[model samples]
Target: MSKQISEITSHEIKVEGKSSVNQKSSVNNDLSVFADGWAIDTAVPLDLKKSADKDYHPVLKAFLAGSFSGTFSTILFQPLDLVKTRLQNPSHHVVAATVNRVQPGMITIFANIVRQEQIAGLWRGMVPSIARCVPGVGLYFSSLHWLKAKLGKTRNQDLGPLEAVMLGVVARTMSGVALIPITVIKTRYESGVYKYNSLGGALKAIYKAEGLRGLSCGLGPTLARDAPFSGLYLMFYTQAKQSVPKEWMQSPSAASVIHFSCGIMAGIAASLATNPADVLKTKMQLYPDKFPNAFSAALYVQQTYGFRGYFKGAVPRMLRRTLMAAMAWTVFEEITRSIGLK
Candidate 1:
């Protein structure tokens, strides 16, 4: 009987051990499930994180983003650009003793184009405009970033407003060199001075008539306008962005609004400052024989139309440039953010 009791006791102890082992296993499984749930709730998904990692070189990414942004803005605002170009072109004359007896506004120009040249006239020189803008913006942005990085390393400090301005000037000057030919074509086409049917034809005609010099018609004025314009734009844009509320900066929509507003203000200031150079560029491109150079163009404009000649297209330029800058910078920033480059 005692032996039987011992066997039964031993069996009961074995059964208790097995039950305890099962309970521990269940507890461990529960803890693992809880931990996994916590991680799922708190951690970013691995796939999403990987996707956000930028695969392209930084300069290449900037170039692509800048190109896309510039193209998009140019397409949307080409009509405004055409109007501005016509207004700025010295070759287009507005008769002072016209039936209206008023200076022609953008509305009048638009009406004239539609009446005489059809609505499609509003998109004149769009191809050359796009051609100039894509590579120009791409080089401008990539060079800006590249210079900033190099300068930062050399200076061993964060880029300041002055550095930003210098970077802008250098970048724009470089891009402006490549922009001259396309700009000449675009300005001539928009001014209704050139009768070429296609972009290739325009290029061939310009080259055949005046060779390389004709293609680089407004280079001086272009550099003068673009360099300072870019510098002022970057300075003002950086200041404006810095002025935004910290809390608002955390919200993408709010940040975009700030960017757009700042861009408009910056663009207006820069466009006004650079309007005279822009006018000269247009005149030189449209009538290289007449204007000859930046000085000659400015003198001719001053003699013909007085100080107001320099500001003829100021309104349209402000509108187009403001909208384009707003869109381009906003889109570029968003792209950078999406690619985890910001």
Candidate 2:
């Protein structure tokens, strides 16, 4: 009886050992399969990952994006720009019986230009304007990004609102310095005071007549106008954008609308604030002999035409600039988002 019982016990033990071995083998096999599948699923090509990662430098991307935005806006709004230039020309006005009759108002001036000079004449300075805007905007955006990066970075911090305004001023000032000549040429061409056969002719004529000074005619006034405009615009836009709800900012369409609305408001405020400087700049650039310096020009305009004169082209300037700002900023923001930049 004892021998039979011992045999049964050994047999049971052998059966249990076999079962444990089988279970272990099955678990090992399942784990191996799972690991293999995981390896296969996760094995994406390095080249593809690298290709996806590669992107333009932020500054260069900003430049290209801004160039496209500015050029498109300039082309579409050239007519408004032309009318603004003509309206801003101090020489065009005739003080007749207390009312400024020769220059008239924005609508009247636009109609007269279309009637007398033809519709195509509204785009007379388009070439110079485009030439100025493309590179000017490119430089402006690139420099802005560069400056922002430099200013924003600290031991462990980023940019604030004040830093943004400072960045805008520096960026605009640098670009303005480089683009003043082209701006002078565009203003003169649009003003109808100078008759040049070609852009080259205008350059030659200005260089011969007034030297390098003529090429940079209203640089001071331009800086005065642009610096404050840029600073205030950036500050206003930044604040306005921050005021939007996070959920509204999440949707692309909603975000675009917000950006555009902020841009228009910022542009209008800046345009109105800086209209006097813009008038002075235009007058000095168009008639350098008549208005030698920015100070003299400002005084002359104020004394001759009074408070209203400072805002001669306010309507067209406001409209054109607001549209330009909205389009440029919206396009630029979209481009940066697509390119995987913040």
For candidate 1, write residues 1-342 as lDDT tens digits. Answer: 999999999999999999999999988877776776754235534675555454567888888888988999998999998899867752334434235655677887887778778989899888898899988888888888788777654322445689778988999999999778888888888888678898889899999999999999889888998999999998998888877777887889888888888888899999999989999888888888888888998898899889999999999888898889888998887886776557
lDDT to native, each model: 0.83, 0.84
**What are the models' TM-scores?**
0.81, 0.81
Residue 55, model 1: lDDT of 57
TM-score of 1: 0.81
Candidate 1 backbone collisions, by pair: none
Candidate 2 lDDT by residue in tens digits, 262-338: 99999999889988999999989988998899989989888988988899899999899888978888888887777
Q: Candidate 1 deviates by what RMSD?
A: 8.3
Off by over 4 Å in 1: 1-55, 90-97, 100-102, 153-158
Off by over 4 Å in 2: 1-55, 90-103, 153-159
TM-score attained by model 2: 0.81
